[model samples]
Target chain A: TQLLEQSPQFLSIQEGENLTVYCNSSSVFSSLQWYRQEPGEGPVLLVTVVTGGEVKKLKRLTFQFGDARKDSSLHITAAQTGDTGLYLCAGGRGKIIFGKGTRLHILP
Target chain B: GAGVSQSPSNKVTEKGKDVELRCDPISGHTALYWYRQSLGQGLEFLIYFQGNSAPDKSGLPSDRFSAERTGGSVSTLTIQRTQQEDSAVYLCASSPRGGGLTITEAFFGQGTRLTVV
Candidate 1:
């Protein structure tokens, strides 16, 4: 069985602070995706990274896929209150597998 | 539908009863997936279906849980003899295609919140 392990399961930081969460796995994936989920709603896709050592940016967010395709990271710069939510990383081989997620709380 | 659609946004069921959850994938999408999520947790994959091939049921928790996708468009998840532990938000997602060397973006539904009392 393949499992994705996420770090800093819970994080709370003041507004304007920078934070980074990580997702790691022993199994290599063909693609990795990041998602943000607010309360009472399903996760919304943030970005998908398919190449090793690839980086994708969406506004204040930066997502990186490791060269080995076994790990990924999500870094938020100057996080705002709107960034508070659950950040999830999903790795796909023949099937998609999700990390437990990091719950971020950005204080206003 | 413009996006993945799930029925009965909320369900409160008694223990030992059965429940059926429905999902309507986006038109022309050949990949459908079902997942269960507990409070503030990551999605627990339940099942996956791609095109006309057999579904990947490896993720189903037990025999009590079963799902079927009809005509490669809509899917249904049935849980028999429901237990309290089964309470969670059941999420459905769809993609243009999946299950090979490539994967596409998945569109998700709002999910159906199940409460077993």
Candidate 2:
């Protein structure tokens, strides 16, 4: 079975602090997607990384794809209270395999 | 709909009862997917429909779970004899095209929360 394992199941940091979440897999993926979900709502796509060793930035959030396409990471710089949410990583090909996710809380 | 839409935002059913969840994909989307998210867990893919044809149903947990799409627009998922373990958020998503040779982003709908008691 294809599985994406995420680290640091839960994180709580003060405002202005930085954090990083990781998604790792044994199988290679064609693409990797990052999503953030608020309570009672579905996940909102944050970014997609298709190329190996690629890095993309959106505001304070940065996403990196591993050179082998078997892992990815999300780094949040100077997190704010609004950044508190469930963050998920999905590896996609014909179907998507999701990681358990990182539940982050940015205390202000 | 401008985005994928799911019906009955929340449902509470007794064990052994059956329930149906619906999904309306965005217009022009050809690939639809069903997923389940348990508390504090990741999304689990359940099924995939490509323009009214299901090319992959391997993620379905059991025979009691079945889904179908009609006219390449809306899809329905039926869960027979609901169990307490089945309680979760059922999510639906749609993509522009099937991920056969290339990958595409999927737009998701606010999921339906099912509670079996």
Candidate 3:
């Protein structure tokens, strides 16, 4: 079974703080995606990285795909309270496998 | 629908009872997926359907867990003799096309929260 392991299961920081979440796996994936889920709602896709060593940015958030395609990371700069949520990484091959996720809380 | 849809947003059932969860994929989407999310855990893939045909059912936890999609639109997941371990949020997702060499991001429904007593 392919599994994605995420680090820093929970995070709490004041507004303007920066943080990073990591997702790692031994198996290679064709693509990786980042998602943010709020309480009582399904996950919302943040970005999809298809190439090895690729990086994508959305506003204050930046996502990176490892050179081996077996790891990924999400970085937030000057985070705000609105950025609080559960962050999940999904790797896709024949199917998609999701990481356990990091629950983030940014206090104002 | 604008996005994937799931019914019975929440369900509470007694142990040993049976429950069925439903999913309606977005219009024109050919790929649908079923997943289970325990509290604070990642989404566990249960099944994947590509236009009414299931190419991957590897993630179904046990024989008691089965799902089917018909007409390439709606899908149903049936759990027999429900147990406490089955309590979780059952999520449904769909994409415009199947994932393989071509990876497509999926859109998810709000999910059905199943609680077994």
DockQ of all candidate complexes:
0.72, 0.67, 0.74
TM-score of each: 0.97, 0.97, 0.97
Q: Which stretches of candidate 3 lie over 4 Å from their true place?
A: none
Clashing pairs in 1: none
Q: B48 in model 3: Cα distance from truth in Å?
A: 0.7
Q: State model 2's lDDT.
A: 0.91
lDDT of 1 by residue, A1-108 (tens): 889999999999999999999999999888889999999887898999999999999999999999999999999999999999999998775567789999999999
Cα deviation at A73, candidate 1, in Å, is 0.7
Pick by DockQ: 1 or 2, better one:
1
Better of 1 and 3 by DockQ: 3
Query: How high is the lDDT of residue B81 in model 3?
Result: 100
Superposed Cα deviation of residue A70, candidate 1 (Å): 0.8
Look at candidate 2 and tell me the lDDT of residue B3: 88
lDDT of candidate 2 over A1-108, digit per residue (tens): 779989889999999999999999998888888989898888888998989999999999999999999999999999999999999998766676678899999998
TM-score of chain A of each: 0.97, 0.97, 0.96
Tens digits of per-residue lDDT, candidate 1, B1-117, equal: 698899989999999999999999999988888999998788999888887454578989999999888887988999999999999999999888887665677889999999999
List the candidates ranked by lDDT, beginning with the highest.
3, 2, 1
Q: What digit string (tens of lDDT, one per residue) describes model 3 on residues B44-88?
A: 999999998988999999999999999999999999999999999
